[model samples]
Target: MSETRTRVADHIKHSPGVHFNELVRALDLAPGQVQHHVRRLLSDETVRRAEFYGRTHYFPPEFDAWERGTLALVRRETARDILGHLLEHGDARPDDVADDIGVARSTLEWHLDHLVERDVVRKERDLHNRVTLVLTHPERTTRLLDDVSPSLPERFVDRFDRLLDHLVEG
Candidate 1:
């Protein structure tokens, strides 16, 4: 691989769940340049990708489907906060989780939809049908938690979502 291609590969290797725009920005490369290198990397199987919602996250070849999904969500600040809260506190009521995370219920629900769909989190119901959010793989999720740090754009997007939720709620 060329130096540029290697750099892209290394970035994706180190940052398992980095999305496209973030990758371009992080590497200080033009979008076209990044796209060309990424295409080469994908063709050679040096790295892999997962598309979650509207974003396409790149990963090294080692991460399985579950880890790919989990990492994709983990790259989002709100979703990461939710997972971190649950990881530290165990399963709890959805309302309590929203309150504890200081996010609107709708925001929490939005992140929860992705988390639950990814199987990184599960919602359990008691006999009364009350819901509790539980991590599907506590130990693994805890380890993967350190694998990603949300970038400025990623954080901004998540915060924007929260702001919109607040607007709608009010």
Candidate 2:
């Protein structure tokens, strides 16, 4: 493999769920260059791709389906915050989690939708049918959580979504 390709592969291996644009920016390579290398990486199965909640994330073939999904969610600031909050607090009411995170309820629900659908979280209801967010695999989720730190672009996108959610709520 060429040095550029090696850089791309190693970045994906280390970051594990970095989105395409972020990868390009992080490596300071042109889009076409990154695309060519990433295509080859994907072709040889040196890397894998997973799409969850409208974002396509790249992995180093070491992550399973669940890990890929989990990584995808955790790569975003809002989703990571929600997961971290639930991890620390145990099962919590949806409103409380939203309030604690200081995100609009709709924004929290948006992330929770993917988080719940991906099995990172489960919405359990009491006899009165009140919803509480519970982590499906707390230990595994915590381990994954500790490993991921979102890129600046990822955090910007998440903050933008929160802004939109607040605007809509208003």
Candidate 3:
């Protein structure tokens, strides 16, 4: 795929509900140019768009190993950090999570919010007024990872291993 299409695909995979304007901003492409490529991507079925907040939001199609596919579109380094932290202890505060992931608080919050919005993770408020994170279903964690953006069933484990290594090395 062209770099632009890959960027669009990755953006949609990570932020399933992202709009054209946001895509334009994210990719630093003009609105018309972004729209053109997005339309092509949609036609190819490599990406999809959905209605959200009264505008069109893009996403990847449901496939076998969705989570790994979805993570591929995300900032891999950021995702590596976030997933590593979650898989280790299952949850943490947004602040601690930021530290764990080596991201700014706002960036971590962005990723967390996106994850929560996608139902890939759950959020809770604790007694100390701190935000707590948890994977909604432990049993489905593997499945969730598998289904995030769709991948071949055989590649799930291998991809996950690489994802882990990506995080660890970061």
Give the number of the best model, judged by lDDT: 1
**lDDT of predicted model 1:** 0.90
Question: lDDT of candidate 2 vs native?
Answer: 0.89
TM-score of each: 0.95, 0.92, 0.44
Give the alpha carbon lDDT tens digit for every residue of 62-147 in model 1: 99999999988887889888988998888989998898988999899988998998899999999999999999999999878899
Candidate 2 wrongly placed segments (more than 4 Å): 168-170
Q: Where is the poorest 10-residue window by lDDT in model 3?
A: 146-155
Q: RMSD, model 3, all Cα superposed?
A: 10.6
Candidate 2 lDDT score at position 13:
86
Tens-place lDDT per residue, model 3, 12-41, is: 776654566667877888898888888899
TM-score of 1: 0.95
Off by over 4 Å in 3: 1-76, 143-170
TM-score of 2: 0.92
How close is each model in CA RMSD to the real structure?
Answer: 1.2, 1.5, 10.6
Better of 1 and 2 by lDDT: 1
Candidate 3 global lDDT: 0.62
